[model samples]
Target: MFVQFFYMLRERGVPVTPTSFLRLQKALSLGVIGSIDDFYTAARSILVKSERYFDTYDQVFAHYFRGATILEMEDVELTDIAKALLEEWLKHPQEMAEALGLDEEQLSRYTPEELIRYFLDRLKEQKEAHHGGNRWIGTGGTSPVGHSGDHPGGMRVGGTSRNKSAVKVAMERRYRDYSQEGPLTEIQMSEALKRLRRMIPHGPRDVVNVDKTIYETMRNGGEISIVFDRRLSDRLKVILMIDNGGWSMDPYIGIVQTLFNYARSQFKDLKIYYFHNTLYSSIWLDPQRHLRPEAIEEFTRRDPETRLIIVGDAAMAPYELTGANAAIYVGQKESRTSEERLKFLARTFRHAVWLNPQPESSWGYTWTIGAIWKIFPMFELTLDGLEKAVQHLMKRH
Candidate 1:
């Protein structure tokens, strides 16, 4: 049973090593498997390491072990249970009222679903209100009811007018009003606030401090002196490779922005390349460029001091990392051969660190992640990991 469970976890992408499997077996042998909840607790303790892994484990456990009856039950059945629970409380209305410190009249006024729906509805309404009016188009500060504007055939409000020509005029008027930059609607305002918040720095050290550290390292010819000297001499170039999509966007964006800021202040000779998936045979410095036959040769001749930092979730199509692969998205048209590019990148970089938001355990099923892991040092997207990478780079220098 334990072996089956381990296999199930492996199927679900949890990284269960042979050593871990043995430990789990040992734990299970010592204990009497009493309850389902107890088993779940033991399994989680032995198997799960990261928050991302825990989430996947919960999902897989539910799919594999949750009872059929539990799975089959719909919200209606839950509603029935809620109703029964409510009724039981109603029977002891005086005691319930006293315990809740609520008046009998107030308690009688609402049903279970009614109370739930009331709060849900209130929340929905509040969200809508926060976002401002929902009408997609506007009519020159006037309520969307018909209004005339200066146009050849005059504007028709709301519906299409008798003259098809007038429809264009109406659309022009609507577009004009819609494009105006008034006080942003609730949603726009909220998003703007979020962006502003994201831009604010959180770390103890500012970019100036980072620059100072680099400068100090350069001044001292011990370790970091070599890195700076190589960078200045063009013997080494830092290539910051970032993943710009999916679940990694938020954390990677923050990490990249911070690093970019630091680099801008500290190192002026660095080159950064951004890619979504694995690097193929021919990688262009600028992805928008058409890759020529000589692109790979030209890239190799540069001999840049490459310190590659790959930030991603590392979850992609399995073939993306294994077997024969081509450029992601752009087929053979102007893209590089994927496998060759990745190999070249690995060979070129002096130090390569892969920052993954999905954690190490989640890398089990992802072929691409495992492939990248073999080539680059993989670390969780945490402050400690970032600091460790920085320290490693500093030591390398």
Candidate 2:
């Protein structure tokens, strides 16, 4: 089994070595792994040298084992009663919502910590179903701990999510195959941005000018005179606008997240915002699309020289962008259409580029992709694509 697992990783382009495999075997023999989870963690640590190969490793591991249980049956504390409640709510969601007069405004919000505590407490204490109330472990009410209801900050126990407001999900699989492909790791993305960092330098003369000092010393007859200059602090203000609200972007979320996480730490002045389909009236700070969104004007008002990197497939109906079909944010309409908004963004940010996860070959097949490509320089979201995009941004910088 172990030998098969080793060969599977290599076959899948993971670059697994014999030394690493032997180390994994040694660890297993020494009883370093007690549970399946422990073995997985230990094997990953021993076998995978780079995070770039982690996704391949995970796929190989899953294939070799047929399937690995994330949580053992005995380890889970959920009861059959909870399962029954989920089913009941799913069957009669609308009926329960109407009976309770359950509206989002009536719901009370709870902190994540409070929600967890309350959810666990109610799970243990409550023995019967209670409907349409603020404080119970039942459905269709203002309670911060149940499904088929409204709570701005709550724990979703079970059932289909109405609004994406739940702070934490207890157990569910609403979306399919969300596992990351891990195309771009943090290190790779950060290295690409490092080129941009080299271009922009501002504020504080902290770094010593070594060549200038030596030249000055020679001019002053061997008397040492040091010169100081501004250190290259990352003064490159960047606005990362990502489209994560649709299913098309689900697969690329891993690469997007890697870029976002690295860009957050890489740039001194960086602001991240989320949008759906295309640029509209407003953009959200949270990926869940729950939080109050900021006006598009707020972002455009920033430094015009700020590098704008838009990450999306740009695959949408032409009507969605051309204003033949209205695309509003949070029920509020904008004076400008989506296409107009895209034009305005291009004009506002002097330096902007679009990073499309969709392959460059298939880009021409999508009408919206070509439409947006004309407005902004579009590049693939791979490592090579990122390097090219960075180079384009630097030219404008």
Candidate 3:
């Protein structure tokens, strides 16, 4: 069972290494785990190292174990009626409450949380999927679990969120899509990239005045202590690689430039480089930003404290991510693969990140996104995503 489980994880792109698998087996053989939940705890702790793999790990674990169900649901249509009509009820929530048989007196009797509990009581009684029904937990009905129905508030188990009264939402796959998809304004991207430049708490030390600190401390009570009076270094040493061209990348050029400009404003020592899809042998530093005669090994020799940031969509033909002479570089004479170059960068840099302008929801559709995500901790080019990625980097250094 463990062998099949391990294979299933690998097949699902979880990247479970053989060493991790061996560790898990040794742990289980020693009876370190005690229960079903314990196995989950032990397996995940040993098998998964990064939070980026959590979604994939969860999927593979649920599929192989079949112990619990993934509660997230896709948008389902209520019977044959258009979803627009059901959505209209959002405008008339009070009428929906009346239509659902809730009286004003009853609303006064319970808090909103109790009302949700009452609805869940009704939901628990449901046994199967229902559509166009007057009762039971289903769609196109008065049931609270399904959408396009007349209810004050429902769990929104399935179907599109037709009303604002979805007091409970299982999981939102659309939120990420909307965030990374088109319609993202410049202001939002600016705000997101602005969070990347954080004041690090520690850096190269300035002069330490021991005599002054001791005098100051003695001047006060014994309770007072000497202050470090440390100053923050605004020095920013970062390298950026932006994806240059392609039809798929046209929509994101503006956003990428916004991040580029914002990062430039933050770090005076920001080394800017350009690569169309991925990096190969080396990166270029020229007046025209062309990949003009420079070696990646030179940049690799830079102080390890330097942070490297890659801004790209990370979307390409699946084959582009695989092969020795991969990546569309300037000269196209490099001998190493894109993955190898990235591995070298990760080893060389103190903190490396890939800020993808593409939506996270779309990542599962392409194979290379997974490849890149494995190479670097990827975050969307959105404000919240940039914040998360920056926070991770800040904690690391």
Candidate 4:
């Protein structure tokens, strides 16, 4: 059985050396392979570290073991394993939950779901913490390099002595005392206000004079006269529509929280809507309620000054993107064709932007993303992209 596992991994392009096989053999000899669960744990300890091997491990494991031993092990189903594995990925959790056929709230309450979400969130938070979403932070004023210190042909120092010196230097640097100031009671709100302020015009004086004047008046007083500024007439209202699932679960919630904070501080009238899929004929204004026949009509009759920002990965079944029944709740009879929906949505708003998490290079391969791109030409996938989108919106306004 151990030799079979080794051969399986080897065939799957995993570099399972003789030393690793020997280590696994010793572990098995120590009576660690009493049950399938024990065998799996031991095998993982011996073979897996970087999860890049997980897909191969899973494929080989499934191909090799197709009996009750693998299937009926401790009530753990394939979905359970998939959830466990994917919790580490920076992908959409809501989509994963849906694909796994698990209820979102119910899974959220479970230990496994909580563990997965927590891990993924922490990973993203750490990535964001490096430079607050800048992505191009310099390391000790060094230019950004394609490779870290680990690449074989990279400019990193070689040999154990050099590595030890580097580690010593890193350790010697005194860690800053973050304890001086306790964690802000409301970091999200604070960050949101800051981001909104950053989006305001900071260009030539003449270009932004009217905007600055209107903003100043609104800042000092409660409101300003729209008649005073001709440019204000062209400025569009903004409606930010966001997804509430997968990796977006936390970030979207944060965005909403930040928007609310901006609304309170700036006193700007902005509308936000939440949806799982793209809006076709209509969207449910109240997420608590299902989509009604009158929803589209109500949205259409709203002020034409509105601009729309739709934030989601647009990842779903291909049919969901183009078929007659693509709308979330509205039946085929009431559903708008994809093109018509896009046109109506664009016409309703002065400008439209789609903020997607998946990078642009991956767009065309995904049916839903491709469909969204066809509709919203300005779809973007990075923090910088989002910041630029905000700038564009403010400039148009």
Candidate 5:
């Protein structure tokens, strides 16, 4: 099994050397590799020397084991009875306003708080199978609840989403086949990333040498002696989320990784997290995206001073951004939509901006891009865009 695993990694272009393989095997023999997870960590540490190969190593490992698919989709069945009931329930537009003791005119003028309260109140009253009717749990209604419907400020239930209306999207994503196929140079990319730098002064360090300087000045008599002071640099604490693994983003993977590597070198206090298509529940730090699972709230606790930069095209299917459906990886259930997650993140991070790799003209054509732009002032991936994004973050900060 181990020998075949070595051959598989080599075939996958993992640069696995005999020395590295022997080291891994020796570690396993010494009872160091206790579990599957431990074995993976050990093997990768030994065999994979470059960070760029981590994703490929993970894919090869999973392929050999027949494990979870990267962007796997599964079909969830709805019963014929349930489907019929849903269709039957879709007949009337629910009088959602009346259910909460307000009419259409009054509800339209309702304050944000009032609307929330009204929705909550109506939710408490709903008990039976409802459809297009104004008062029941059903479809095609004016009610703030239920889907495939129309209502001002309606809270849509399961169905086609308000793709045009969503204000945000989670920023992290995936990389399908981790191959840096381009001839891009890190030096050039890092130089471009320099546009995003925040050159504020780092906090003061070490005591001043006033006494020594004075003594030296006195000894020199005519001229004042100078003490060389260390220069101050802006110490930035940044949380960077990179969206990867989409067909639309295939051309920009190298661009994204280059930016990532550059950011790591530039921001000493940078914290990186990853996600796919959309952020439903969490973000990850590892290429496998399982070893370091970070909850949504984890981002909120980051220092408010930390500038949160999200890099992605922000182009994806509408369902990935809105509704209750985990459309990409089916059978996964998330209480909040991708839109809600982005809203939370924006509100939580005081300084945040999105850097989009796609051209500005293409943004209007993609529903998801337009949706995200509403919440974040997105900039193009060029130097000017990065400058604009940095300037915005600075101004907001």
Candidate 6:
């Protein structure tokens, strides 16, 4: 019965597998789904593995269960009556509300099912655009449906938010870009980085050691004897170097900085530094690059096990990375070229991953991006990319 629904979910990129569908079938057969809300909750729990895809799931569910052929406010071609009604409603919204007998208290009383039913009824009855009236899919006033309206319940059809009280947004999907495979947020980045944590025993033995307890108990003629061992603590050391130079990097500065600050607070031995375009002799302590620069050798001298995460667009002039022009080292004598510095950093760290803010698809189009990518395992600065990078680093660990 739900074969079409299952296929629709898959077509919409919800990643619904056959096995999970069978499980859902079994669940339905067992009489678990009692209502539309129950079905939504249960189907999502069974089919959707990640919360990021909840928006897509909601869209699919609404399309399948709720009336799908309803025209949004924008899609409705304005008839003469609709145009006249819109003008009249806009001129006197308060008077129109009194005439329509619609208010916030009445709208607030609607349950989700009632709201959906009301929306479908409104769609069936409303054949044109509504501007400021209540009880129709339109803009302004206290409608349970439509955008820029004040409503405590019902679906938002189209247009920008004004009241922020839509039970379900029937507009364009808001979280389309928030899939697990999409771009990175600070929280997602932090969660991906957390997977890199390696816990080892440290400090005092405050907790009971199970293995030791079992061994000692067996040796002591089965007497119950407790053993305490050192608590396991995070031993992961990370050095985050971000590219914060040039106009090309301005867009990525905020998110990258947020991740850096989060990492500094999260990991015990995390060191963060900033660089411009490409790695040179010195890495900066601040974003403005005004403070005294720290030598790159300081990080290079660290233990080889230290993981390095380099966040940059890597979209710079080839000369900036390749050529040792006078600007990079004019009067001062330097032993290493930019390429050599990159190579040295890559080799020094046992596990290093380069996170390019530019999408991976465009990596091949840029020259400098390709050059840097050769030296490190480069991945896009996205949730999927970060997770893959973490997996790569974990494999080495």
Q: Please name the candidate that would achieve the greatest TM-score relative to the true structure.
A: 6
Q: Global lDDT of each model? A: 0.49, 0.67, 0.61, 0.52, 0.63, 0.67
Model 1: lDDT of residue 293: 24
What's the true lDDT of residue 65 in model 1? 60
Residue-level lDDT tens digits of model 6 in 1-397: 5898899888877899999999998999999887655676688899999866766776776677664542222222222233345447546646544544667466457553354334433543554344234321111244332121211122323344454322244234554434323224457668887788988999998999899999999999999899998999999988888776554553344456556656867889887777777887778777565576887787766978888899888877787777765234355455567887889888888799999877698789889889998999998877778889998887755
Give per-residue CA lDDT, model 4, range 1-397, as digits (tens). 4688788679767677888778888887888688665565567668866444544554555456542122212323222343346744326657756755676775566564364555544444544444222111111234222222111122222222333332232222211121021111234334422344323333333343567667777877957634232232112356766565333333233333333344434535566665655665555444433443235546678777565777777876666666766654543454556556766777776567787755577677777677677777564534456566666655544
Error of 1 at 304 (Å): 5.4
Candidate 2 residue lDDT tens string, 1-397: 3898888778777788999899888898898788666776688889988765654565556555555433321212243233334346436645434433554233235332343334434554443344234331111233332132211112323245453322112123322122223245677777777788634456888789999999999999999999898766557888899887645564354467667668877888888888888988778776655676888877666888889999999998788888734784446666777888888899999789999987798898889999999999999998899999999998844
TM-score of each model, paired residue for residue: 0.37, 0.52, 0.47, 0.43, 0.47, 0.61
- Per-residue alpha-carbon lDDT of model 3 for 249-332, expressed as tens digits? 533544565565566666778877766577767665642335374677777579787778888888777656677765554446
Poorest lDDT segment (10 consecutive residues) of candidate 6? 145-154
lDDT-best of 1 and 4: 4
Candidate 5 lDDT tens digits, 136-190: 1111234322122211223223232333211111001122223332233466556
Q: What residue pairs clash in candidate 2, if any at all?
A: none
Higher-ranked by TM-score: 2 or 3: 2
Which pairs of residues clash in candidate 6, taking residues 3 or more apart in a chain or in different chains? none
RMSD to native, candidate 4: 19.8
lDDT of 1: 0.49
lDDT of candidate model 5 versus the reference: 0.63
RMSD of 3: 20.7
For model 4 the local lDDT of residue 163 reads 30
Residue 65 of model 4 has an lDDT of 55
How far does residue 311 in candidate 3 sit from its true spot (Å)?
0.8
